[model samples]
Target: MPYVNIKITNENVTNEQKKALIKGTTQLLVDVLDKNPATTFVVIDEVNTDNWGIGYQTVTEIRQDQ
Candidate 1:
């Protein structure tokens, strides 16, 4: 019963990539912590750049600067 929460900015991540992320994360837990894949839970949360902030600036603003 391992629950993992992953947060990423909504920057056009493809479904294939997201699937890989989930699979890899689950495998990591299985390898490191010996967690059961069937009982492992992974949640991917996509937040809009405007809603994700870093160092007093939104991800959108930071990307704009970059």
Candidate 2:
């Protein structure tokens, strides 16, 4: 059994989006790596935009610039 953990932080990510991401990523890993879905666990951790930083800038701040 292989365990996988995934962390993603995005201001636009909703609960549904997180669920889809976990499911999709897990499926991909299982299909590509031939792992068992039942034994494979995927964890998605959502972080606040203020806590996430990119190049010394907050994700929220960066998105604002974009």
Candidate 3:
């Protein structure tokens, strides 16, 4: 079994985008590593900006600066 873990900030990602990510990831694994898609697992973890940091600032703060 192949397991893939993806982490992204909770920035209002759409359901269709998430689905596309899963499909693309699986396809990449199949094409590159010859992994079995049926047994492949893709897990996406959406993390809160407050919980994610960039250097000394939180992602929330970073975005506010931008």
TM-score for each prediction? 0.93, 0.73, 0.96
Model 1: ten consecutive residues of lowest lDDT: 2-11
Q: CA lDDT of each candidate? A: 0.96, 0.80, 0.97
What TM-score does candidate 1 reach?
A: 0.93
lDDT of 2: 0.80
> Model 1 residue 52 lDDT?
92
Clashing pairs in 2: none
Model 1, range 18-66, lDDT digits (tens) per residue? Answer: 9999999999999999999999999999999999999999999999999
Error of 3 at 65 (Å): 1.4
Q: Which residue segments of model 1 deviate by more than 4 Å? A: none
- Model 2, residue 25: C-alpha shift (Å): 1.6
Off by over 4 Å in 3: none
Where is model 2 poorest over a 10-residue stretch in terms of lDDT?
Answer: 2-11
**TM match of model 3 to true structure:** 0.96
- Residue 63 in model 1: lDDT: 96
| Candidate topping TM-score | 3
> For model 1, what is the C-alpha lDDT against the true structure?
0.96
Better of 1 and 3 by lDDT: 3
